[model samples]
Target: MATKEIRSWAYDELIRSPFALPQGMLGRLAGRLMLWLNDPGELVTLIGKADSVLEVGCGPGGLLRNIQAKRVCGIDPSPDMLRQAARHNRGRDVELRLGTASDTGCPDGGFDVVVSVNNVAMWPDLEAGIHELRRVTRPRGRLLIAWHSATGRSPIARKNALPEEKLARIDHALGEPTRRYELKNLTVLEKHCQR
Candidate 1:
């Protein structure tokens, strides 16, 4: 757990902003805002079809609801968020659990695809989170890490877009042969093959 050390205090603080780590009543409000602001259609299209999918930092399960997979799973650090996700995805076959990016609680090589949206920068240790995500994905499976986009139409997305250096660090952690895609409100870093 702590193996995934915080990258730095300042970065941790920035990532753990109230909206990013929602709690209490305010957290509920933030979850509602997230549901309205973030759309998963582009991601779903990019991911295409899969037998199974795992969404880390799944927030309110918006992506989970839209993902076209026979088996969909979501993990989040906040119990409140997990509750929201469960409620939001009711009547669906989605599995919602309380977990973090560094500890997904998923079996190794169990997923065809593992994705994290709008929470890559929020990860306490980007490398450790990526490593865990990689561990759970089958060989040649896709790892999709998306965040606010620099070219986003929304000011919120533009303001929160990661700097190039930070993006490069993520690229390095994901290893070579990764591709970058700019969607309406998200910048997706897609990696294939497992180290």
Candidate 2:
């Protein structure tokens, strides 16, 4: 299937909602809401000054703004989200682009750290997305995948938190996680190095 068709199928079968793939007027509105709902300070601290960072499914670039990287780039499938992200990170050196997890238009081994938050479950092909993300990460680099936490304070987090089985699937795809822990409203899987 083409990317667009896959996205449409994924929207119905995997995501079942626009909350993951924000687009159009409603998507722009969703981007604004995401700016207020998600906070990236703790994630930034964990990232801790990488030379380059890439955020997959960056949405409105909330985390891109706070990342302490010398070079920062973010990609989302939605042009509307990219527009919002560009506006959100305006006057900053962040690069906002239209791309997806399986086909990020970045050079090989280009990023010190690659992260995806709240959108992994929506990826049309889990293993393919993981493979592409790893391809972009340098040797001994890190891949951080996070999702809403079941124990989070926000109801959205609680509702969206993946089941243990689903989390286990992600862990298997990424190999063993260096650490798996909850940070505020997110449950994070940190994989150190490409194995």
Candidate 3:
């Protein structure tokens, strides 16, 4: 399904309802796991210095807090995730936008770094998400997509080696190199202005 539909479903499934969404020790544990999975210093190194950073699927915005960018914003499909991120950003200079990687509300070339953490593996259309990442990121800006790959398989990637179809989609989407780290299929994509 398209991102719009997925966003709508996410909004309904997570928020706007009278009942409460899932939360508790497990959620907290999972949040911590996500934080550990996406190392902070590595992100700092990747970005060099934080400027206008945008994080896609920033659940709870834990990683966003670590990066001291001039201006930081986040986009996620789920309202619950947005709410969680907002709560995490309480008293902080961070903007949480309700959207998806496929289409964020920000203007083009507005971000110095476009990073997606603990997401993308389950993206309904990964290519669309990558295109959006390429769109918002500034010239020569970086795009880091991190997913929990227990066996280094993407969980969806099955292995660091993406199949021809997936590679084709990524190639056609970002129009640049998407490298996978050793033992971690958390794909890192870079985009340049004149690519």
Candidate 4:
């Protein structure tokens, strides 16, 4: 997603509909259930002993909580989203930062794992955000990103639903075959993540 397109989607689609599916009532329930069911796979894999975790664009801290790490931090560019996260994670160990992914205030090698769901492609400077994530992650750390493609939304709440033109912009920006990635490893994008 390009800057304007992603920004618009975040404000219009994401802000308006944080929970539920992008399809309909059944989709919403299925999405909700999937969130819980998929928790162990997404959360557990991003943690390790002696690891400090950082989550970019963490919404409501659900992923943050599910990770089950004592040392964890999160950042989201939207104040509204941060407020929601604060309300949910108040008095918890999670440190929620109010900022964008591209310029998160963190020191080099500050974290052992950096995780994001449904946000990497949305970044205006995708590589910059990736750079930041890599910088914060110590050697041997991992970065995980998840996204919901145009096929459909499991939770069909109102979505900004990018216009075909916007979609084209994103397709052009990211290059061809923006396919789903395997969790096992990244034989691809290794140049971006290597220490």
Give the range where candidate 3 is weakest over 10 consecutive residues by summed lDDT: 1-10
Cα lDDT tens digits for candidate 4, 1-195: 111224433233432233321223433343345345334353354344545878887755666765666688988765545555676677788888876677889889887777666565466666566667777877766665544434333332114233445444433433343433433211112112346
TM-score of 2: 0.91
Show the colliding residue pairs in model 1: none
- Estimate the lDDT of model 4: 0.55
Using all chains and alpha carbons, the TM-scores for the candidates as numbered come to: 0.92, 0.91, 0.69, 0.61
Give the C-alpha lDDT of model 3.
0.62
How much is the lDDT of residue 82 in candidate 2?
88
Candidate 2: tens digits of C-alpha lDDT, residues 88-139: 8889999888899999999989999999998888888888998899999999
Which regions of candidate 1 are displaced past 4 Å? 1-16
Which candidate should be chosen as best, given lDDT against the real structure?
1
In model 3, where do residues sit more than 4 Å from their true spots?
A: 1-38, 149-172, 178-180, 183-187, 193-195
lDDT of each: 0.86, 0.85, 0.62, 0.55
